[model samples]
Target: MSKLPGNAGVTVLGDKSVEFYRDPVSFYGQRMDRHRGRVFLSRILNRPTVFVCSVRGARELLCEKSNIFQKDPTDLMTNMYGDTIVTTNGEEASLLRLSFSSLFTGNSLESTKGYVTRICEQHLKDLSSRGQCSYSVYKSLGTQLVLGLFLNVNPDEQPELYQEISCLCTQHWHGLISAPVNVKVPMWSSGFSTALEAREKLMAIIKDKLQNDKHGLVGTLGSLPLPDSSSASQHLLLFISALIPKALASLLTSFTLALSGNQQVETRRKAQTDADYLGFVLLEVQRLWPPFIGGRRIASQDCTIAGFHVPKDYGAVYISHAVHRDPEVFEDPDSFRPERWGERNAGQQHLLCSFGNGPRSCIGVKLTDAFLKEACMYLLQHYDWCVDPSTQALQYKWLPVSRPANSPTISFSRLDENPPGHSGS
Candidate 1:
């Protein structure tokens, strides 16, 4: 097998985690160009890592050779979220997936549709009343939807409890990004320590819900065939965490910006009326701007990804942003062309890694898809929107959730309702 193109520099001194975290798009883009290849070697998190930026390599790493390139058990996710499906490996992971899959798919998912519709309408119907809206507003809406669906914590009905849990979730999420050290003193405490405290409080709340609330996902999850008593609570914490909401808000914001303004009025109109076209629009938005930069895996055995050798114990990361734009799979990669999904890239949704691919793909994908369509359709039906300043910087910051760095605001005008079901077309 051929050696990877780039260097896996020596240990901590050579670690490029800081640089990668700062601007991962540019970091990987520069190396991909320099190596003249999509798959290259680099040091990240103080490990000899192989960076996979091509669709072929990603497919091989995450799908075909997945057994050899496995999830890292010692991943930061484990410390923050506990021994949940996200960080487990082997049979344990498989079992957890089997049990939880039932909650997020099929009838369990269909039941959430009514709640999704009501939440979308409640949050989106008044966009024009405010004239302009920012990312935070959508994020709040996302948070409410997640908490309400997963924990039965409705913001409208139990505003106090919702706000408290929301604040705790934010604190808990901060630990995922902050230093791993956990320390506390009389006057000073690390973010990690505070996060741990928040986790305990959230866990208490979750445990109570699981015991008392005999309805919704929480109730059903409490009865699942899990390995241990704590499994249900741990997984509930993962679901109610701030991460999903941020991701939901990220895509919603990108969708708004992508089709905004008079120039794309026809496109917006088409998306509203044509469900397939709306799907294409959402797909394009994700392809160009994925919420998460990528996911990481470790080589369990010697393996080849897109013809590059990855030795056992080596780290492998797939950059969704880079993989989606691979010219071999996506023509005119950077441009937003919804038609491409219907034409050249037809039946190629499998190639995209926005929610990842293969067996380990995000479990909530179906639920996420349903919620996004409902939210987007609400916006399309209620108002016509455009970037408030039009010239505002729309550059994205990837880490912790991908949204514009400046949090661009958009102006919305209520569509005239002369005829029933008017679309302002």
Candidate 2:
């Protein structure tokens, strides 16, 4: 195999973690230009890492040779989520997946649709009246959905408890992104430390739910054949995390922005009426604006990805943004054209890594799809929206969760008052 294009650089001072995290798109874009290839070497978290930015490379790493590139044991996800499936590997991981996936598929999943619709209607019904909405507004709706679905913590029934858990989840999430240092001094503590404390409180709440409330996901998870006693609680914590809500909100926000304005009037009308067209619209939204940047793995043994050599123990990261835009796979990769899904990219959704690919793809993807469709359709049927001020910046930040940097305010108009016209007809 050909050697990786760029140098991994020296350890420590040569590490590019900060730069990569700050703006991974620019980092990979500049390097992809310099090295003239999608696969390259860099030092991330002070380890020699292979950055995969092409569709072929990502598929090879995540699908064809998935076993050879396992999840990192020391991933920050493990630190925050404990020994949940997000960090586990091998047969243990498989077992965890089989056990937990039951909660997200088939009957269990079918049961969530009604709740999803209710929550979407509950929080979204007032958007047109408010006249404006922001990322946080959608995010709150998402938060209520996951918290209620996963832990049975209804915001309306127990508002104070719901608020407390939400705040704690936010703290715990901050820890996942913060420096791992556990320093504490004189009424102050590191974000990671604060996150751990928040985790403990959240765990207590999760445990109580699992015990007293023998219903919903918490109840079902408690009854699963998990590895150990703490398994259910740990996984519950992962499920009820702020991460899910943020991701949900990210996709919803992107969908709103992408189909906004009079220009997309015909598109929105079609999507509202045609299920396949709406699916295409959602697919396009995910393609252009995936919630997470990408996922990381560790090379098990020496391997070749996209024809480039990757040494054992080396970190491997796939940039979903770049992979989805690989011109080799997507024609006019950067444009917002949902019809491309119907034409060129038809039946090729597997190529997209928005929720990842292969055996290790997200277990919660189906549930997420159900919720997103419910929320998006709700918005489509009830209201039409556009950026509140036409001149507002719509630039996006990819980290933590992808959304407009300024949290662009959107003006929503009830469709009943002002129906969308069929521009083409």
Q: Which of the numbered candidates is closest to the native, going by highest lDDT?
A: 1
lDDT of each: 0.91, 0.90
Q: What is the lDDT of residue 168 in candidate 1?
A: 100
Alpha carbon lDDT at 10, candidate 2: 91
- Candidate 2 per-residue lDDT, tens place, 272-349, comes to 999999999999999999999999999999989988888899999999999999999999999999999889899999
Alpha-carbon shift of residue 115 in model 2 (angstroms): 1.0
**Worst-scoring 10-residue span by lDDT in model 1:** 416-425
- Would you give me the overall lDDT of model 2? 0.90
Backbone clashes for every candidate come to: 0, 0
lDDT of 1 by residue, 180-233 (tens): 889999999999899999999999999999999999998898779999999999
Cα deviation of 338 in candidate 1 (Å)? 0.6
Model 1's lDDT to the true fold?
0.91
